[model samples]
Target: MKKINLNSEIEELNPEELDHIEQALLSRAQTISKLAYAPYSNFNVGAAVLLENGEVLQSSNQENVSYPVGTCAERILLGYAGANYPNSTPVMLAIVAQRAGEETWASVSPCGMCRQAINETENRYQRPITILILCANGNVLRVKGISALLPLKFDDLNS
Candidate 1:
C-alpha cells in the first residue's frame, strides 16, 4: 500500500488585501444567492467562475419542483460557461452558500457530479481552476485547482 498525502492551501484575506477581481467574484456570488430558487431546502447557493479572457460568470442554484431535477450552483455556472464560452478555460471559481434567514455564510463543497464536470473542464482546458470560497464573515478559503478538491480522479486523459 502507498500513502498519498494531500494538502490544501487557503489564504485568509484581511479585507484590505482582497483583490479587486476576487472581491467582485465574491460580491457576485453573494448577490446571486438571493436569486436561488430553493423553496424546499431553503438553502441558497451561488457560484462565480472566472475565465482567462477576463470573463466572470455568476450563477445561482435553480431548484426544481420535482426535487431531483434541480441543479447546483456550480453546475449551473459550469454549464453556462460551456454553452456561452466553449473555448474559454475556467481560471477561478468562487462559491458562496447561505441558509434561509441566516445572516452568515457557510462553506459549500461541490457535489460528485460537479466534481466530474470540473474534472472534464480541467482536462479540456489542460489547466487548473483556482477556487476562492468565502464565509459571510469574510473568511476566504482558497484552493489552487479543481483537482485539489477531487482526488482519486478518473479520466480518459489520465488513463
Candidate 2:
C-alpha cells in the first residue's frame, strides 16, 4: 500500500475584493436565498452556477414535508443546469445561506451528496468549477475546484 497526502487551498476574501463575475454570482446566490422554501428548517440556502457560455443560473433550497425528500440549493442548481443547459459547462458556483430571523447570513458548505454532485459536474465538463462561498457577515471563501473541497472523491466502483 502507498501513502498519499491530499491538500487544498482556500482563499479568504472580502466582499469588496471580489471580481465582477464573482460579485454577480455571489450576489445572485444571496438574492435567491430569500426565495427558498425552507419552512421546516428555516435555513434558507441559495446557489448560482455560472456557465462557460456566460449564462448564470440560480436556485434555492426546496423543502418537503419529509425532510429526507428535500433537496439542497446546490443540487437544484445542478439539476436545472443539466436539464436546460446540457451542452454548456459550468465555470463557477456561488453559495450562500441565511437563517430565519437572523440579520446576518453564514457561509454554508455543500452537503456530502451535493459535493459529489459538484464533483460529477467537473468530471462531466472536464474542467474545474471555481467555488465562491459567501457569508452575510462579509466573509468570503474561494476554492479553485471541487477537488479542493473533496480530495478523495468517489469516481466509480472499480477503483
Best TM-score among the predictions, by candidate number: 2
Q: Among these predicted structures, which one has the highest lDDT?
A: 2
Residues 35-130 of candidate 1: C-alpha lDDT, one tens digit per residue: 999998999999999998889889999999898899999998998898899888899898889999988887677888888888888888889887
Task: Itemize residue pairs with steric clashes in candidate 1.
Answer: none
lDDT of 1: 0.85
Model 1 residue runs over 4 Å out of place are none
What is candidate 2's lDDT per residue for 1-159, written digit by digit as tens? 998988899999988889998999988998999999999999999999999899999999999999899999999899899889999999999999999889898768998999999998888888988999986568799999998889999978788
By summed lDDT, which 10 consecutive residues of candidate 2 come out lowest?
130-139
Model 2 C-alpha RMSD to native: 1.5
